[model samples]
Target: MSDTAPTAARTEAQTMLIAFDGSPEARRALTYAAEFLRPRRVEILTAWEPVHRQAARAVSMSGLRQADWSPSGEGEDPAYTEARETCREGVNLAESLGLQPRAHMVECATSIWSAIVDAAKELRVDLIVSGTRATSGFRGFWQTSTSENVIQNCGVPVFVVPPAEEEPDADC
Candidate 1:
């Protein structure tokens, strides 16, 4: 018998929540998480705005008449479908990295950042990994970075991977 008291062993692997939008930046973030963070369990999330909601916003902004738009019961929304596909791709990437991955799709009811934060809270993940588009200038000012927003709102630790830098011109 050992002199030291035996400590409880951790049975479950550490879980990480990754925010993926099918973008190159998001893919890089996932790769970074797998290679550096080395999380054993991962949840890949794709947050998307509903088609109808997008149309409504477009109408409101453009002063166009709102058309009667409803989801067809026979088919899924393209936005949701795309989100699912993106999540699948992320899952595949994670699996290739040798980490167990699950896919999650969440509607951007309020904001994409909010959706990510809520999902993180619900999943009870150890960390949140996201990619930034690195928007700047007027557009950046008007549309706040999703990674920045998630970092500000979420209680969990957030790892934001920025887009790869462009190579300098050889002619210059």
Candidate 2:
């Protein structure tokens, strides 16, 4: 008989906050949480940084009249719209797992990491779950990983799920 040992399962978290951006890695993290921890309550928080030119200009420049800045025929900002859709998807995923989920789309004026940490604090979740992708080269060195930032800045516990590594074909 093989002497393989079974791994003990971790205790389920009471409340969990998932940082989702509708990416494939984020989806995997969600799946992992649903199958593993299965927290009592789940909340999906998407931090959206507005990239709209007019909005940024208004916020950046001083003494700029808000009434003078009119949208250049653009009805709604796409970035925010996508954020809302992502939150909805997270909610649907949670429902599929037999859990009621609350979705939050927070508009971040500065950085995404700050927004995530703030949400976790405001919500007072027991844990935070997010996914991270491996990066290389100079760009990777300069850019800070969101997961890493959350782990550092957030007071609550954080679970960062790395992307699944691709396996080479046996034929090779």
Candidate 3:
């Protein structure tokens, strides 16, 4: 008899949530997922903080009166608009890579990581795909990476794509 072990049966099609922010690292994560996991459905999510909330924070920090600033009710917040565009870009990229993708924009109530985790839970995705900026040292310590937080808090599995390595110089 052969020495090879039997493989487990494959599960049904999986749904995946990708935290996208139109960064090169995010693109790499999407490419990795498409090449490796091959999930049946993908949700491209872009999270942004509302303009009013941001203005409020600025005012509070500067010790300015709340009445000094007011949100324009004319149209959608610029942050939300940018997030929607980013999500659309991600969906297009996913489609070009042969993935069935849907765009999702989330308003960040607390933090980007929190929004991503909440969206993943709401979507009931089998896996979360994210990319790391590869921050380290004092800066990294001060500013916690989103992927790190997601991995720690997300109940589901997470696939994180690290920043690409720099190419060696030809002259060297």
The best candidate in terms of lDDT:
3
TM-score of model 1 vs. true structure: 0.88
Over 1-172, each residue of candidate 1 has an lDDT whose tens digit, in order, gives 5545432333145568999998999999999988987777889998999888888987998998898877675688888888888889999999998989989999989789999999999998878999999999999988889999998999878999999999999999
The residue pairs that clash in candidate 1, if any, are: none
Q: What is the C-alpha lDDT of each candidate?
A: 0.88, 0.81, 0.88
lDDT of candidate 3 over 47-109, digit per residue (tens): 989898988877887997876546778888888888888889899999999988988888889
Rank list by lDDT: 3, 1, 2
lDDT of 2 at 14: 61
TM-score per candidate, chains pooled: 0.88, 0.77, 0.84
lDDT, model 1, position 92? 95
Per-residue lDDT tens digits for candidate 2, residues 35-142, read 887665688888887656446555667665555444455666787788889899988887888777889989886778999999988988879999888666887897
By TM-score, the better pick of 2 and 3 is: 3
Model 2 residue runs over 4 Å out of place are 1-13, 53-74, 169-172
Off by over 4 Å in 1: 1-12
- RMSD of every candidate to native, in Å, equals 4.2, 7.1, 4.1
Regarding lDDT, does 1 or 2 come out ahead? 1
Model 1 residue 10 distance off true place after TM-score fit, in angstroms? 6.5
Show the lowest summed lDDT stretch of 10 residues, model 2. 1-10
